[model samples]
Target: MAVDDFNRADSNDLGVNWTESDYSTPNSLRILNNRLRMGEANGIAHYNGTFADDQYVEATVTGMQFGDGQTGIAVRVSGSQGGFSAYAAILWPVSGRVRLYKYVSAWIVADAQVELANVPYTLLTDGVLQFSTVKIAAIGATIKVYIDSVEVISVSDNSIASGNPGLIARSSYWVELDDWTGQSLSYDITADAVTNGSITPAGVTSVVGGGSQMYAITPDSGYGIFDVLIDSVSVGAVSSYNFTNVAEAHTISATFGPLMGQRALLKIRPENCGHITINDNSPQYWFQHGDNIVIEPVPDAVYALKLYVSDFPDAALTTGEPDSLPDEFHSCIVDFACYALSMKLKKWKQAAKYYNIYVKNLTQRRKDYIDRKAEKRAIHQIPNNIKYGGTRQ
Candidate 1:
């Protein structure tokens, strides 16, 4: 069994081995709506069991208010009466970001943070409630994070490898959790490459059933895929393999041999600029497409002659271009630029048409992006049949 759902009225009963932290206040944490809800006090509800090193823990939290509050999941927790420690992946509504923290001595320590999309997330009420699905996957020293089914962060840390699993919340927030699940995988999968080749999804071993594990074989320069093996059995020399609905443990290995003869290397000269200038008023030195470059600066006689320039590449307009605007709406760049140009030329009708096109494109792109993200979430559903054990049970 790989999943657990707290959907019963007595879900909080100790008989199920669900225990609150010694620091949590009585009645501050309870089961409601078949989900765990936390009240005003900062608290942690721990499942009293020891899980393996490679495991995944996740929960869906809702009814979170936007203030100095956070709610999330804790894994690999270890400590005693005076001090307890664990790694927490939290949804911080106030900051509009998801953060990973290492908690020790009752203090939360920041590890990593990523900003959330500005789109209006699914909300039950008008600006009063927001929900998020937070998941943490730990395999050996590598830790991967996912929010609402989107993979956000992947880090490596081996400080705390194995311990108990639980939930965490800060003060003055009412947070509800559902589909809280933890699984202890049975088998370990590993991979090794010889002669300048690499494999991915290699380090991960505790994948649950119905989960798809993709293995990508990448060879270094001057090498080609020679052979691929699964559990020492030949699986041909394919560049990639997908193990869908993985239900058993297996070992994968790839080997790379030399490419035919010697391959010529190609190189290109760097771009050269005629001159450079320094502008303190500008937020950044790198200019993007259509960005206005200002030449005027307040005169300071002593520093006027000094010039400092940095080599910055011009931003490109492409499918994979990185920009402040969402990637899906990158196609509207032309419409937006045309709208601005029309306004400058005092062409009211042309400006309005371009503006409307830009708005419509942006709105439709946002909807499409949201829909694609929703599909990604459905692909990684948490496994079922998780068990929590304690002395009371």
Candidate 2:
């Protein structure tokens, strides 16, 4: 996407992304109040990037300095200054006429009147600042002209093969231009996935000018990818797929199925611990589903399990639920809650009192509960499944 809102400091130069040509002496093109203002007639400003052959340039004409002159957007612009090849969609506000013109070399003679809306020249100056919007699209041999989003002209012309898009003014100045945007034609790709599975970026995505994109396939726990399809044709059970240099729209989907195996999910767990050992042995393969653990080659015997964790609740405490903190230090939680409530109610004095009490109780709780632990450094092992999200990437 190429867009220039002209929101820049006032200057004769339009920065590095624009090339300017003055047909007349001292052609002044400056950015003022986030709009492009022209000071001389017959001057053109072209965007610096090369655009595809099939592209469109559009701009909202907020102000027209002279209704008798013509101003519009040009596409497939080649050459520079005096001589250039471009298809221009010109608009004449005074006569309410819009025209399509093909410019070649130093002479711009060919003109085809596309539409005449019979709009008065005084209507633009009668307190209204914005009048018309001009847009031109060149695709293949077809050149289209649009006035205020209404297609008025569709002609076949292939004189210009490829170039940049730009803004041009003829016998016009101080033509305020805003929301100038240009882009190559783009196509859409729709991606979908069935239940128990997902395709990354699963939606309608727009790609331009033979762009490429990649999609990742993922299945829910205890499920395996069954099949993958592109454009309704099966592409096998691939974990990922890529669309290289995409030229047209496409569709992609994936299906999944439950894995065939004896499985068990252990729900009971200590807070803030991941590693697990059964019968003093670490299971070689296991994955976590939510808070539960799923171990492969399910353990057959009743075994003792050990893990490291604090007694505190794994998640925030909800209303009507008892906290995991010891009963002796329960007042600390109450004090903190009171402090938060007081702060919400904007009672600073009450909030300060509760906060001080919370700090005092917290200090006592730390001394009673935390001091019992011996000063020692221990390394906690991370589960292999969690280390790589249950996949050996």
Q: What is the C-alpha lDDT of each candidate?
A: 0.55, 0.62
| Candidate 2 TM-score over all chains jointly | 0.49
Model 2: per-residue Cα lDDT over 280-367, one tens digit each: 5745223232354554432122334333222232422134422255566667667666754543333345755775565455545544
Give the C-alpha miss distance for residue 391 in model 2, angstroms: 20
Candidate 1, 1-393: lDDT as tens digits: 234566676434423566666444454466767777665456666677666656678887656665646677877666742466667776656556666666655543223223222222233345554446778766666666787777777777766767667777666655567888876545556877755879986575666543667788887765656678888998766678777655468788988765434221111111211111232333333433233233321211111111111122432212532225555556766766675454333234575577556545544554455456533211110111111111001
Once model 1 is optimally superposed onto the true structure by TM-score, how far is the C-alpha of residue 262 displaced, in angstroms? 37
**How do the predictions measure up, each by TM-score?**
0.44, 0.49
Error of 1 at 109 (Å): 9.1
Instruction: Name the regions of candidate 1 deviating beyond 4 angstroms.
Output: 1-4, 10-15, 105-132, 185-393
Clashes of 2: 0
Pairs of colliding residues, candidate 1: 2-384, 3-384, 3-385, 3-386
How many clashes does each candidate structure show, in the order listed? 4, 0
Cα deviation at 249, candidate 2, in Å, is: 4.8
Reference-based TM-score, model 1? 0.44
